[model samples]
Structure formats: C-alpha cells, structure tokens
Target chain A: MSTLVLPDQQVRVENTTVRHVRPTRRLGASLRKTLYRSGAIIGFLLVWELVPQFVLEPASRVFLPPLHEVLQQLWKMIISGDLGTHIVASLGRSAIGFILAVIIGVPVGLVVAWFAKVGDFLNPLLEVFRNTAALALLPVFTLLLGIGELSKVSIVLYAAFFPVLLNTILGARSVDPLLIRAGKTLGLNNFEIFSKVVLPASVPIIFTGIRMAGTSAVLVLIAAEMIGAKAGLGYLITNSQASFLIPKMYAAILTVAVLGFVVNAALVALEQHFSRWARA
Target chain B: MSTIEIKNLTKKFLRSGANESTAVTAIESLDLRIEDGEFFTLVGPSGCGKSTLLDILAGLSTPSHGEVLVDGEPISGPSLERSVVFQQYALFPWLTAAANVLVGLESQARHGQGPNKADRRARAHEYLRLVGLEGVEDKYPHELSGGMRQRVAIARALAHEPKVLLMDEPFAALDAQTREQLQDLLLDIWKRTRTTIVFITHGIEEAVYLGQKVAVMSAKPGKITEIVDIELQDRQAVDDIRSTRQFGEYRHYLWTLLHRHGRQGEEATIDKTLITSGASA
Candidate 1:
C-alpha cells in the first residue's frame, strides 16, 4: 500500500492558541510598563523632596523635617547599629509568627477542604474568629500569654492565619473536577489524588494567601510592638515621636514601608518559581 | 471470548430540581460484546448516554440494573485493565508530559509488580516516543497544542498497558486536520498494540473509519439500533477510503438510521424545556 500524506486542512492553529505576543520593541513596551508603575512613586518622592525642602522647612522647622534630614537620621542610626537592631527584631518577629501561621494554617486548610463534613462543622466558628480583628484580640492575647514576645507573636499569628487558611481552603476546594476525574480514571485512591493532583494545583492559590498574610503579619506585629517594646521598628517610630525626634520617626516609618514592599516582592518570586508550570 | 461484555446494561439519572424531581433514563437494556483486540466504536446523538455507557464499561459509573464484564469478571470500579480518555484532554496542568504518563503507570494496580522508578521513566519516554512526542517530554500541558495534549493523554493511557481502552470523543476538540491526523495515529497504534478499544464519537465518519464494527445508537433512552461491520479492502490505506462508494454507503446507512431515531429525542427535549419554561412563566 502506498503511503498517502494527509492534506493539511487550512488549519489556523494559531486561532486557538494563546500566546504572549513578542513585541517588536520589547524594551519599549517593558520600559513603558515600568514607567507607568513607578510614575506615582517618582511624583510622590519629587513632591516630598521639593515641597519639604523648599517650602515646609522655612515655614515650620520642628513640625515637618526635610526628606534629606530624615535620610541623614536614617544613615546616622544605621552607622550606630540601632537601626540594624530594630530591623532584625521586627523581621525576626514577623518571620517566626508567619512561619507558625503557615505551619498551622496549611494542614488545617487542607483537612477542611478534603473533608467536607469537617469544613461544614467549622464554618460558623471560623467565620466568627475571622470577623474579629486581631488587633482587638491583642489585649486578650497579652493577658493570656503575657506582655512579651509571646503576646506580640500571638497577635501576629492571629493576623496571618486567616488569609492563608481561607486562601488554601478556596484553592483546595476549587481544584478542577476534570483533573480529579483523570486521577480516578488512572485508578488513584482519594489520598493519592489529593496528594498528587489537588495539593499541587492549590500551591499557587496558597502562595497568594501566604503573600496576603505576610502583609498583615508585619502590620500587626508593628502595632503590637508599639504597645510595649524597646527593640523593634515600631518601638523606634513611637519612641522617636515621643522624644520629639521627627526625622527618626520618619526614617523608621519609611523603613517599615520598604520592608513590607520587600516581603511582598519575595513572596511573588516564590510563587512564580512554584507555579512555573501554570504559565507559558 | 470477548474482552468486554455488556449484559442488559441500564443507567438512570435522577435530576432533582428545586420543587420536583424527574428520572432521566440515560440507557435502557443495552447489550454489547467487544471481542479481544478488536476496535469497536459507538456512534449516537448528543445526550444518547453513549458516554454513560462507556463510563459504566470503565466502571466509573455503575449500571442501575445490569453489569459490565471484562475478561469474564464483573467490573466493580475503575481498574488498571480499563483506562479512559476523556473528551477534554485531561492532562494534569502541573505535570510535564513524561511525568503525566509516569503518573498513570505508577497509579496502576500492577505498579507493585511493575518496573522500578527509572524503568517506569524509560517506559513513559518510550510511549511518548510512540506518540511522536519525543523532544517535548519536559513541556507542560499549557505549552503544548490541543492535539499534542491529547497525544499525551493517549500516551498516558497506553503507558499503563490497559487491556481495554475507552475513549470518550477524545479528538472532538481538535481541528479537522489534527483530528484526521490523530485518527490515523490511533489506527496505527491500535494495529500495533491490538488493544481492545471502545471509542465513542458522534461523528459517523470517525466511527466508521476507526472501528471494525460501528454500533449505531438511539437516544432519549439509549439503545443500539444497528451494528454495521465495515469491511474495507485496504484498512491500512484509509487516506482515500472516504472517497470510495462503499464508505459513502456505510455513512449514508448510519446517517439514515440516526436521522430517523435522533430527531425524536431532540424534539422531546425541546418540548419538555418549553413546557417547563411556560409553567415557570
């Protein structure tokens, strides 16, 4: 029998294809996107530098320090190692609390998602807890765990837990039924399907939760530290403000903002690495 | 002895609405026997319960009153001996093509007696090669074409070495050219492996082309209307077979049978929906 080459029908396979268009001017497109994003930061910084230096300083010296003065104070604190100590203390607390939340939240979320009955039973209780602010619970935690590292960490854990828990539950529950069916057709047991398919699929969404929780963890930790702490970034800000050191207060606040930004960026990188398969 | 035996198989579905419940009879008293190593196809209209029947055969869905026996034993649940290829190429998006195939092998009942990890990896590679996907093993599902993803699904099914392969409109989503290409590829694989295949499709040409015997089914309560034996002179050279008079006659025969029975089910559906909507209004 003679082999016949199949005639290719007008197959516009590209019509069904979803591809990121390679811009003819790749640098231009990316640079434009970057500029659009950083436009607000640049405009804000320019206003901060110009208005505070040129206008505010001459009008009121003690009230609003120039951006340069704040930067200078930040430099001085860095040289004296005080700023480094506060940075370490703040990061350490957030890290410990966030890690604990992840450790507690992930398995609990997976269990609730995997077992519908357990989830249904816990739904009301979780809703109640999730609704109550972690900051509102700070006093109770302080009384229960004492006004120390334990109390501060507890508050931070409370803040961090709900985001991760909720996201993980959503992710696990939303796993594509097609994948579950495929797993069944492959003769995989329920546990095998959960481990091999559901867990892997939920990783991206779990990362999203982790990122959100990390932001809240830092915010709550700083607030908790401000209550009674001598060695954290929050302490630096409140203490400087009470002592009437405007520049130092500004410096501490700026550092905290930068730290939050860095933490979020790191989480995004981790998510990208884990979910490499999800993107083309 | 047949590799698969469907004895008086019936499946009914209960569709419960807000206020009322109705029993939708999907299949009623369907009997089919697929010989070992034979390629059999089931063709029917949409909602004909052809898929329900296939699911029952795969043991993913239980028959309401009867049983599906594979190799002389009644199937209780999904087994390694019978694997399914869903209409949507249900390749795990998280896994690479090779990993997807390996997963099937690892999940099979014979995994305990099967080759070690390295050997299993090699077998996966071999099957991917068999499907003409040699260099794309590391590519994720999103990175591959629709046809390529379906090929990976096929490779995954074949890697487990199932005695009977059940495909549910596997190539229905592909473009025409790719669909024809895959049809040829499947025929080639079936010829080489001689795995007893039960393929389900609404396409009469596809059913006739792929199967030794094509079973035409009717809907509303699905039942086999006819089983036509396709006796082509040169099955290997099927590229120009559709142009032949014999192929057209078979197509015309199946089309007429379907045209007669398929319309009643659809009209009933339209009338029922209209009545329901009128009642609600």
Candidate 2:
C-alpha cells in the first residue's frame, strides 16, 4: 500500500509542468525580448545617421543636418560646461516639484478613499482641475508666483500631481476585501491593516503613477523653460533659433530629448525594483 | 470553556438601488457554541451563509441582531486572538514570504512583547519552518507556486499564535493532492497547538475529514440543519481517516442533507421558469 502511494505521488509530481517547465521558457522569452528591442533601436539610429546625406539637396540640408554635425555641437556644449549647468538646474526644479506632488497627492488620495462622503465632495473639484492642462495654468502661475523659478517649478508640480493622486486612490480602493478580513482576524489594528496590507498591496500601481509623474515633470520643465528662462536647454534652443544657429538649436533639442529619456529610464528602473512582488 | 458563543444571531444586507428594497436575510435567529481546542467546520451549499457566519465570528461584519461572545467577551471588531486564513492566499504581494510573516508578528508585538526586528525575523523563520517552507523565505509571492503562496499565508496566520484559527475555504483553489497535503498539515498543527478552529467549506467530505464537529447549514436565509460529532477510535491522519468506514458514513449523511438543498434549488428554478413562460404566453 505504501509502494502504491509512492508511485502515485511521483506521477502527480510529474504532471505539474508549471513546477519545472515554464520557468526555463520564461528565461528564453525575456532574452528574445531584449535582443528584439536593441535591434530596433540600432536599426533606427543607422537609418537616422545615413538618410539625410543620400536623400536631399545642399541648400535644403538645413531641414536635416548630418549626424556628425549634431554630435560636434553636442561635444562643444559639453566642453564649454554650459550644457551640464543647464541640465542640472532644470533637473533640480523638476525633481523638487515631482517629490512635493507625491508628498501632497498620496495622503490626499488616501483620505479621499477612506471617507466616501469626502470623496464625493472632492471628486468633482479634482476632476475639473485634472482636466485643466498644466500648460493652460502657466499664465495664472506666472501672474501669481512671478516669472521666476517658483512659477516654473509650480507648473511641473501641477503637471505631476493628478496621476499620482488618481492612481493612489484607485490602488487603495481596489484592495481585496478578503485580505482586509484576514488582516482583521489576525488582530491587526486599523493602522496596522492600512500600513501592512493596504499600503504594500497598492505599491505597484502607485509606483506606476510615480513613473508617469516623473516623465510628466521632465516634459513640463522643458515647456516652462521655453516660455521664459535665461539659461537651461529650452533657453538655449529658443536663443539659438533667434540667432539662426541651426546646429546649436538642434543640439539644445537633442539635450532635452536625452534628458527626458534618461529620467524616464531611471523611473522605469525604480518601478521595477519596487514592484518585484507584482511579477507573479 | 467554550471558544465562541453565539446567541440569537440575525444578519441582513440592504440592497443599494432605486427601489429602497427590503433587506435580504443572511443568517437568522441562530445559536451555536464552539468548544475550546476543537477543529470545527461549517459546511453548506453556496448562499447558505457559512462564510457570513465566519465573518461575524472574525468580527469583520456586525450582525444585524444578536451577539457573538469570544471566551465570554463580545467581539466588537477584529482581534489578534482570532487569526483568519482566506481562500485567496492573501499574502502581501510586495513582501517576501519571511517579510509577510514578520508583518503579522510585528502587529502582534505591538500589544504584547514588542519584539525587536531581529526577534521578529527569527520568529517568522520558526513559523515558516513549521509550515515546511524552510529555505524559500526570501521568495516573493510571484516567485512561488500557488501551493507555496498558500503555505506562506498559513505561516503568516500562525506566526501570531492566535488562540482561535478561522479559515474560510483556504484550500479551495488548490489541486486535489495539494489540498490533501494542506489538510494533513492543518491537522498536525491543530493537534500540536490545540487551538480552537472554525473552518468553513462547501465540500462535504472535507468538512467531515477535518472537523470534530461538522455544522451543516441550509440554503438561503441560512440556518444550521444539524451538528454531527465525529466519533473515531483514534485521532488519525487525513489519508488514514479517509480509509475508515466511519468517515464514509459521515460523508454519506452530509451528502443527503446537501441533496435535499439541491432539490429545493431545482424546484425554485422550475417555478421561476414556469412563471416567466406563463406571463409570456
């Protein structure tokens, strides 16, 4: 009888392919994905580098400059150290604004979700503000805070606030009732349940919101600088364009694009780090 | 001493809609006393309110009428003394298995011994080992299999060393083999700790296999139909108990009660069909 049970258990173990087979397949699939993404990026750059030289006239070349000329301008800016200072200033404002938005938005979202009557009262107001674009509020902010660093940072704050607020509310409200019940039964107090169960469960969605907010902050920073600034990539682009220095203008635009890309990539890395539990 | 005492308990759920509909009764005018240190199960068909009754005992929901007393004190809300394991393996998805267990221990320590971080982690390790998940403590919920996740949930619940363990269909999502293994593990834990347990399940065989007292409930506006006490010669493992003739008798008896409820459901369906067809004609 014991021998009978042994073979039956062995067969049962053999039948569960999830316990063994799928993990190996998942590794192969991720490798393929990395290769595919890198291949597409390399292909795009190659096309970008070669296309203008072969396809257009000399006078018309102003529309699409050669990759080497853009790189040369980029090199000059780096050597002069103007690019680094501008990048740092813009990054500082954006980071400060984004962090402030998160600090304010997360608690407001929690309160809204916790009290239904409060949510009902505030939701309409939130919706009205969220729909009103951050760029649209630029004039209002400039008038109130002046056309200084405060006004610029305020615009980024407005841009980043909504996604974080909305996503945190969504994440908090959608927690599993069963998990709450489990928490209650385990003798966890209201605070403990909120901290241990609700907060941790909401993390992945909240991190997604944070990543979106980070990207939006970078975007708003560029727009803010473009409107009125003496230094920064946006100032460089507008000033160069006025003087008819097309290569310098393109270099400024390139710097903005690269800054946005790097900030977004860092956010993605942070989200992945925090949301490892959500992978399952 | 009785672990839990319920007297004249009634609960109703209000329908939230345009008509201001009358409340739907869940459990009405009920009374039960679960003995200390016994593995008790409530078994019924869906809509029989077994889960609702468990919720009341766990203090997740307030009864519309009557009262529940745990060890002679009325249950106002959830307490650490009565730990619950849910069907959906409610392990914190953001934490590793060890961290999840540590969260439970930390909550317990808030009122009790206030264990430091190192002590809490050590205690979490002990409970994890008890559930036979020794080496996989660092793994997140997504990294582990379903069975492993459930084991982590069990470990988290047990880490607090609650006096009463409440489980609501904790093994319903698992395969037959995993369910059996978990059932055996549950029995071993219960035998060792002698904690009063209130388990709810729809499976008649499972209720009979695990519970010392099986409380069978009727469908809708649920009521306890009968409470049968299992009288076995020896306290045996689940596999050994299943092979016994007494287990078969208890299983058949529960099936008969459930069969009667099934017939009532069919009759209700037929009545609805006839009324709709007649109106259409």
Candidate No. with top DockQ: 1
Per-residue accuracy of model 2 over A1-280 as CA lDDT, tens digit each: 1111112343334335654558889899999999998998878767766777887777877766877788798899899998898888888899999999999988988888878899999999999998998998888999999988999889989999999999899888998877777777766778877887888778888888999999999888888888888777777888888998888888889889888999899999999998877786
Report the C-alpha lDDT of model 2 over B99-137, residue by residue, as the tens digit. Answer: 888876777677766467788889899888777777778
Q: Each candidate's TM vs. the true structure?
A: 0.91, 0.88
Over 4 Å off in model 1, which ranges? Answer: A1-33, A57-61, B263-281
Error of 1 at A219 (Å): 1.3
User: Candidate 1, DockQ to 2 decimals?
Assistant: 0.41
| Pairs with steric clashes in candidate 2 | A187-B79, A187-B80
Q: Give the deviation of candidate 1 from the true structure as CA RMSD.
A: 7.2
- Best candidate according to lDDT: 1
Q: What's the C-alpha lDDT at position A149 in model 1?
A: 88
Model 1 clashing residue pairs (backbone): none
Model 2 ranges with Cα > 4 A deviation? A1-36, A39-47, B113-120, B235-240, B264-281
User: For each candidate, C-alpha RMSD in Å?
Assistant: 7.2, 7.6
Interface-residue RMSD per candidate? 4.2, 5.8
